[model samples]
Target chain A: MSEIVVTHVPHKRSIPFGQEAVGALSIIALGAIGYFLYPDDLAFLTRLIGIAFLVLSLDLVTGYCGVATLGHAAQFGVGAYAAGIACVRGITDPVALLAVGVFAGTIMGLISGALITRFRGLPQLVLSIAVGQLVAALANKLSWLTGGSDGLSGITPGKVFGIFNFDMYSRTAFLFSLGVLVIVFVLLQRFVRSPFGLMCRGIKDDDLRARMIGVSIYPRLVVMYGVAGAVAGIGGALTAISTGVVGLDSVSFERSAEVLVMLVLGGAGHLWGALAGTVIFMIFEHIVAAANPFHWMTLVGLLLILIVVFAPRGLIEPVLSLASRFKRKGEAA
Target chain B: MTNLLEARGVSCSFGGLHVTRDVNFKLTAGDRVALIGPNGAGKTTLVNLITGDIAPSEGQFFMGGDEITGLSIPDRVRRGLVRTFQTTRLFANLTVADNVALAIMQRKRITRRFFSSSTELPEVRAEWSEILSHLGLAKLAYRKVVELAYGQQRLIELAIGLALHPKVLLLDEPAAGVPHDEAPKILEAINRLPSDIAVLMIEHDMDLVFKFARRVLVLAAGRLIFEGSPDEVTADHEVRRAYLGSYADARRAT
Candidate 1:
């Protein structure tokens, strides 16, 4: 007599409404409850959330599109300044401010993309860093428009849709920023899953092969860069609206590096990874600063190094793998 | 029948060294021709010129009645001409299926939508499955390219070229790195391809050349020394002298 045994091979499941739809609904519900309950802390959370969106945009270009860039902060800064300047000049209309920010970001993205696309390898990286420095310097030197080192202050947060005033109370600002983040996140998700996204990945893997297959790399790069920049700029505009102030830090190299760190910390290729990285990094920073003022940076630096050396896939991937493993184990049992 | 591809007075030089000098050749549709030459006879360079990898410094190239002298590689591919690299150029990280699927999808006019997964259309999947099955790679469809053997990688490269639906396929040393036993399968696949798709191959394996190629073009020192049937080429005094320097010894063994 012989006993028969069965072996199961795990197969990937098709997209189910239960997973993503429930996840999205839960996020919105949580945000809505947080908006209404913690009105006092809403403004700060709004700014952090906006920064998260900006980091996601960076990941789209650098991680998915495979165009390593250090000048993405320049586009963000331009959008911030556009909205800030508009506010200072009494342009309180949200639509008008968003328009200016998106337009300016798109133009700057196109110009910078064209300049950088001509180069590859280290030259491209250097060019992107130079672009960031140039934009930051322009913001500083043009004291008339940018308000110089003192930074643009006295940005009056106007009412949203003529209903709730964006004030220190923070209810309106939090909802507004959350709304923007959700829209941008959904748009980016769609973009990455499209045929264009596949082409971008192909270009990243082998530009020569892509070109041989009739996929023009330059035009696609330009378009991706412009769109990513525009999204980042919108993120910056959200920052301006929530904080009611725009500073030179918007375009600072350190800020750019911080965003990159957030991207790496979460996982570059996945959108949610960037968001998780940003939130965790921010929360950790707050906790460390409160616990030890002088050693916060050192602790953060050490943490980043450890993560890079050991878990290069970022914190989220390990969690995801573990979750999947548990699910398979449960099914086996 | 008119030649599907014609190279008239096509000469190319690299910084004062003429690699291909006034070399003329014609490839009619349904032709299986072998390009044999010494180490630096510019056979690969001639393949590059024919495939539009580079422009001819002097002279012209025509494919299917159209002058394609300055067309880009992709444009040339779109016009039903494709070539494999001397070195296998597979996307190392992608699965064998994805590599072929990419070629098939790119040939279509599908608009790129972002953030969505690659929806393998029925026709595209059918084409990919057909090509993979034909190349005996259906079992290895999901395997990463780097995990495959050298000969398997070469077959995958050939499968990619076939997926392009080319009117003419140029194989640059297809049997270069394959083992002795694997050479026959590669040659047999090339022989079994549809008659309408002409094959122009650069090869060093004499047995493969003699067994598979209907016609042979010999290049010595970047000049066309002989062009005719395999028997005619073997019989040419200069061809035997230029290529098979030890023909006398080989004849004794036979």
Candidate 2:
């Protein structure tokens, strides 16, 4: 009995390590291959990857952490404007732009989180909406700094590492965005599996129970909000860098709603789901717009409604179910 | 012996109606006491006050001789004072083990290190399994709380509370909705908790109350009318008249 107990103590050591290793290696390989083969398309791909990262951040807080916010676009816009202004001022360092974006986003997230923490349900949702509107108003009102309705467009791309200049070819830009995305994905995966992540989930389940168990929900939530904001800010900064422009649309309600739709369509609980959703939504937009730009919004709206009504868990869950069924069939054979 | 928990001059009112009126109570380490009263006697309200869910109009509370009257619920819990809800508050979506593990993790000072993995921590996993096994919930560890029966859900709630390793466990009518057959198991488990961990339970069932509590406190219309042994409480005519009117015949039969 003692021998069995001692051996059984380390049972968690069998946590699918081999599968995770393969997955990580494959992601790195795919990123490298994509970076080399499609250098010219990197700029667009970079923006896509950045948007995916932002969506993942939102999903982490809203989906897994159980915080619902409608004001996240404010953070995204702040970062974009900060990076754009920095670029306009001749500060073209990628690292500096990232820092400025992250800092601005963190501050915005903290303020919004603090305001929303005291509320729940509709009240929280309304507060978030108000925050988004407030940021949009600021962006529109601050014409001199943000370039107002004209938008901040005068941007010069500097070298990423003093050797690789951000040419219109977009090779370096794509690699840079992909690199950041990979890092964010890895970090978020670790966070969600950590003790803090578990506590967030616990708070989501029952705030009162979490309190009785000794978890302080408020401060932890504030920190989570800040982290998520920083991620979104980085995505916004990437957009500014790749496209070399920052506009009032960055803080628009439409942008916030679009991200929310992507998160829901992909599934909120999984990190990869956010990426899948963003990619699919972007692809659909591209295809639809190319075919006929006039009715794209209608088609997308219908698609979202159908997805919410028929497959509320999102497309990823159905795919997972299908894969599991195949595995069962294989075993039976 | 010094009381593990003490509340003095505790009064609370809602708008115009007084819910608790200058109530006084104390529980020493190893003590097992019951708060017995009819519905609307402010029994649950009193629990809420002690647990810091609601602030008192005027009162002072002490745990281990340290004043904790103005602390938050989570703060009180950190100071080794904790309470279970009248209604079981289990995480319906999560597995039983995850619920227990969450409770255990709650007490720790968790840092925001985004690169660290949780499942890799041997200590967390081991503690999780240990608590699950202790509650005889090892088999149902993987089952979601919603999938469990009411009795089982109650057990899981208790398991969650137990995982906190609270010095003082306040149970608000733990067996209120629990089936009679399953009540004994819960009562037994409560009885077996470490003697140093004082228990203050509010229960309506006379038989279960008498069987478990060494002493009983009677409340009538938010005031402490009587405090004595279970036998003494049963024998008190005034106490019986004030709160046990419907149970008079039942009391005599017992």
lDDT (Cα) of model 2: 0.81
Q: lDDT of each structure?
A: 0.80, 0.81
Fnat per model, in the order shown? 0.51, 0.59
Docking class of 1: acceptable
Q: Give a tens-digit lDDT track for model 1, residues B88-178.
A: 8776756787778778877774535555455355566677777877777777776778889999989987888888887888999998898
RMSD value for candidate 1: 5.1
Residue A132, candidate 2: C-alpha displacement in angstroms: 2.0
**How many clashes in candidate 2?**
0
Quality class of the docking in candidate 2, CAPRI style: acceptable
Fnat measured on candidate 2: 0.59
Q: What are the per-residue Cα lDDT tens digits for candidate 2 across B1-254?
A: 98889999999999989999999989998989999987899999999999999999998999989999989888899888877777889777777777877777666554344555553456666877776666566777766788898888888878877878889999888887888889886887787678888899999888889888999999888999999998888778998888776576586785
Runs of candidate 1 exceeding 4 Å displacement: A1-13, A16-41, A89-96, A161-164, A167-169, A316-333, B179-185, B240-254
Tens-digit per-residue lDDT, A70-160, candidate 1: 7778989999899889988989876567777888788888888898877888899899899999999999999999998989888775678
Query: DockQ, in order, for the candidates?
Result: 0.33, 0.46
